[model samples]
Target: MNDAFGKRVRRLRLDRDWSQQELSLRSGISTPHISSIERGKRFPSLEYAKRIADALGVALVALCDDASELRSPKMRGSAEELPLYLQNFVLNEEATPYLEVAHQMSQLPKEDADLLSLVIGLLVKRRYETPVLTP
Candidate 1:
């Protein structure tokens, strides 16, 4: 079931210039365990997959195209070319006001700009916040 997923994990690890030992140390997963999983001789639990994915700087879905890959509502692609659905969501009305506010605050002092960006990021992530533009 996880054969392809194991291959993907290996590919991403090498892509990031990490050896199994490095990944193991960073992810707190043992090196032998990472090796077995990468070889498709073992399957990681959901939690371990998450820790590995985070350490690899990838979405867990990148590891598996299967149903067990949990979808995170807050996940945003770092890739330049996103799928059509993500493109549409980024263009939607809900994102417009926030984008406008972010653009307007871009010229502020670095500290002030960062603070405003954090607040805006929080509002965007919470999704239920009243979109009040605060300077």
Candidate 2:
């Protein structure tokens, strides 16, 4: 079991105000198993990871690895310097385009860039999920 992976899971769970039992209930995993995973006594299979990620409303990648590792330099602040919530939020797969757009919009003021990125992210998510009507 990757200790780092387990830590990530525990962190995400806590961020959602979930206890191990709560996470187990939500993910359909047992409390003991969840405890083992969080303690790094056991590793989660891909399927189990997917279940947990789904229950946590996060992308599987967010639990398996540090999203900051994949982020652009501008996004990679010292982990200690960033809030856990913001770190988790930025790491979500759905936030990728928003982060990228924010990077491109860096020339703009920080507040403007952030707002624009959020708008773009919402539009992108909606466009992808919205069904096209036939003519």
lDDT of 1 by residue, 82-125 (tens): 78786786678898886556544643456997897798789788
lDDT of 2 by residue, 10-126 (tens): 877776667898889879999999898889899888899888866665556667766533211132223456889978977789988866554447545569868887998899999
Model 2 misplaced stretches (Cα beyond 4 Å): 67-135
Q: Least accurate stretch of 10 residues (summed lDDT) in model 1? A: 70-79
TM-score of each: 0.50, 0.50
lDDT for 96 (candidate 2): 85
Which residue pairs of candidate 2 clash? Answer: none
Clashes in model 1: which pairs? none
The superposed Cα distance between candidate 2 and the true structure at residue 93, in angstroms, equals 25
Q: What TM-score should be assigned to candidate 1?
A: 0.50
